[model samples]
Target: MEKKIRFVNGEQVQTIGVFAGSETLRGYRRDVATITTTGIDYAQAVALFTDGAKWSIVEVGEEQKEKVYDWSSHGVAGPITDNRDGTLIIKMGKNNTVEQDLQDKVDTARQETAQAQAVTEALAGQGVATVEAAQAMRMMIENAAALLPDSEAAAVPSLSKSWVVGEAVKPGDRRYYAPTGRLYKVREGQGHTTQADWTPDKTPAMWVVIDIAHAGTQDDPIPAAKGMEYEYGKYYSDPDDGKTYLCKRIGEADGGKIVLHYLPHDLIGQYFEEA
Candidate 1:
């Protein structure tokens, strides 16, 4: 039997294959005849077979070009350019490691900025200038050192261990003192043997006194009292409300002594805030 020629859109063609399946074109699937034609260009073939529908012709295994993308919102540093040939060229500002380093620097800068803002707000609340507050803090620290006793008069307790000379100590090591009956913690990065002159009370820079009653922790906050010196950023409990507050500022120095003018209740929003 002789093969019969098929007609599509008024054009004679040969139907190579026919099956109960669909073919996708330009992301759209349509049920249409797949025909082979001779002596016809792409435009002529589409006009004859597609019947004024939008269609494209390609050889078998030929890939279609994808649409260009807008890479501006991708968060990549520097400019990105489409080369129009199925390739993109990106001019990066830095490599992956350098990019991570830049991100870390940005995070550090934000934290510093937040701290500076807090300091500025604290100064604004108390009507005290930055220089005056800083000078008061410096004098308070200096006078506190001069007030330290040369040696504790009380004898060392039998249960508590006395600070022996040439004893090995590292940072964060705690030792009990007989005079104040308090423990002192070594300063950070200060690992050394005990020295006779560098006692816990005498050397405030190397050792910090730990008061269990006024530890500045959430559980045991320093009680708010008049004439009691409060450290900045330490937690304090208000006697009036019994709520915990963080000390944002301390009273100015008077005669080389830190004198707290207002209690935690009166100093709320000025020198203290809810912790």
Candidate 2:
């Protein structure tokens, strides 16, 4: 359930839509038109009804839309209604968790800036002044770029190529082996020599599955079950293993056949059971 706070006090708007029988806080009716509230403050309008908190008003007629209205405007609003779906609704109000989340984001941004500043200051002390040098220093510090000098270590071979012994493998690093059309993710820090040591099915503890079970080129997309029209944005289950695949994008393949962009592991089955 997601309850959104559409409007708040002190919000600036270009224009407001008003309909027939619109009431003022002083109990006077006004005609319908697209009125501007640029000069008028939000806290000065009268509410038409006092049944509950006036939070929003519905713009009726051909196009039904929700607009923000404060107590200062003679707009209609009622108590918060239950709109439960799958996601838990986080309405921003007094002492809500959403405020805490926002604060956490701010704190994270500050910490990241501080880390980057520390790296920049260290590089500056080393007489490195160029923007590219500063960015390269930050990347090295963050372990995003390999720090091993060219002479010290040979080029890190791609996963599609032969395995290089003693290569530093980090957690969550993914690689695809073209020979077997298999993909593997690093689970722990380990060195690999032979190709079999990195095979996904053989080394379960050392690697994680990160690619689609079926792989092919865009021109020759993988085929689904016969007569199965893959609908866009729909989830389909593999009868063999019960794994779910989501159809994201549809594109034409050879001979004008439609191919779906496959996204794995949506796991929407827990929410409802198929009859």
* Poorly placed runs, candidate 2 (over 4 Å): 1-54, 57-112, 115-133, 138-275
Task: Choose the strongest candidate by TM-score.
Answer: 1
Task: Pull out the clashing pairs in model 2.
Answer: 1-87, 1-89, 25-46, 45-72
lDDT of 1 by residue, 157-257 (tens): 21234566789988866566666565565668877888889777666666655443556777889766543456776777876788998777546332232
State the lDDT of candidate 2 residue by residue for 150-266, as single tens digits. 212222312122223445566645454444444445655643443545454456556544333333233323333322234444344544455555444335222232322222332
Query: Which predicted model would earn the best lDDT?
Result: 1
True-vs-predicted CA distance for residue 40, candidate 2, Å = 18
lDDT of 1 at 229: 51
Candidate 1 residue-wise lDDT at 185: 58
